[model samples]
Target: MEMGAENKVGTIKPEGEIYTCPTCGYTDGFHVSFSALKNNRKAEVFLICPNCHNRFRLGWHVDLSNT
Candidate 1:
């Protein structure tokens, strides 16, 4: 699966906090992309800034197996 390719999800509210965009320094809205893997046990994430439309790789694995 592609990490930050055309595979993307959008307009979802982020869980913890909204972050600032490194590319444009905008801090209000964001889009999210999650690539599911390992039979839905794990996922890769992408955070996109709406202001600049810049995509940021959230280089960590989400362990959905916990829940």
Candidate 2:
């Protein structure tokens, strides 16, 4: 999968949380791209569901201390 420049606003190492795709009811994993804001207080997440091939966006809270 190719991610465009606009889609990649930031990179976070996969560590803190495991996300589930709501659209296709997928829990195993996701094709994830994300951008953090407010000094890592929040994040804008873009996810592609592997099972349904559907794209979705999410506003997530970043837990800086977790990692």
Which candidate comes out best when scored by lDDT? 1
- Model 1 residue 51 CA deviation (Å) reads 1.2
Q: After superposing candidate 2 on the true structure, give the runs of residues whose Cα lies further than 4 Å from its correct spot.
A: 1-18, 34-45, 60-67
Tens-place lDDT per residue, model 1, 1-67, is 3454554433334457667765677877567767677666888777778787766665656876755
Report lDDT per candidate.
Answer: 0.64, 0.58
lDDT of 2 by residue, 1-67 (tens): 4445555333334456656655556788777665565655556676667787565554455554555
TM-score of each: 0.53, 0.38
Residue 9 local lDDT, model 1: 30
Each candidate's number of clashing pairs is 0, 0
Q: Candidate 2: deviation at residue 15, Å?
A: 15
TM-score of 1: 0.53
Question: Model 2 residue 5 lDDT?
Answer: 52
Q: For each candidate, C-alpha RMSD in Å?
A: 6.8, 8.2
Model 1, residue 35: displacement in angstroms?
A: 1.8
